[model samples]
Target: MDAKQYDTLQQSLSPKPSIIKNCLKAFLVGGIICTIGQLITFFYMAYFNFTERTAGNPTVATMIFLAMLFTGFGLYKKLAQFAGAGSAVPVTGFGNAVISSAIEHKSEGYVLGVGGNIFKLAGSVIVFGVVSAFVVALVKLLLVTVGVTNW
Candidate 1:
């Protein structure tokens, strides 16, 4: 067959993706994760004597830890498959990416496999986070110097 016919045949055989359903899944899952994070933050503030401002650190740490645990148990991957990008746009998604890489490379031994490869997928995330934080701090410094607001 000619190239155009082959292409048409392939297109006909392929299943169509459901854009609306995928979007709804992503939205629901992402919102659920955010809600869970907020609950953790509130729990820290209400029960752990952490103020609203101070509660974010532990709440984020807790979320990352939980995501790592879920990844380790092979649960996060299933959720990711079902929820699509919804499960991958949050901080917990970062955790899943890191741990999943480490787990994937664990067969090559500890130092070379887990340690070296742990950052393969996550290095960009770390770099972006650090760079963004620096940029924000610089902007805040500029604002403070110009008396835009009190420090």
Candidate 2:
């Protein structure tokens, strides 16, 4: 068969995706995840006496820890399958990525496998965050020096 014929056959065989349904699913799942995070923050503020500003750090830590635990137990995979990018666009996804990578490499040995490969997926994220923060700080510094903003 010719290339054009193969392409036609492939397109005919592929199932059409339901964009609206997928979007609704993603929106609901993502919203639920964020709501859970907000509740955790509120819990910290109410029970632990943390201020709104101070509650952010612990809230994020708790979310990441919970995500890692869920990933370890294989629950995050099912959620990811259902929610798609909804499950991946949050900090919890970072935890899942790190733990999943470590788990995948565990068979090769501890130091060489887990340690070396643990950050294989997450390292880029860390680098991007660091670089983005530095760039933002530089821009703010320049703005302050030029009297366009205040410290």
Give each model a TM-score: 0.80, 0.87
**What are the Cα lDDT values of the candidates?**
0.94, 0.93
Q: What is the lDDT of residue 16 in candidate 2?
A: 86
Model 1, 1-151: lDDT tens digits are 9999999999999999999999999999999999999999999988898998999999989999999899999999999998998999988998999999999999999999999999898799899999999999999999999999767
Candidate 1: pairs in clash: none
- List residue ranges in candidate 1 displaced over 4 A: 1-9, 131-151
lDDT of 2 by residue, 69-139 (tens): 99989999999988887888888988899999999999999999999999999999999999999999999
Overlapping backbone residue pairs in candidate 2 total 0
lDDT of 1: 0.94
lDDT of 1 at 127: 98
TM-score of 2: 0.87
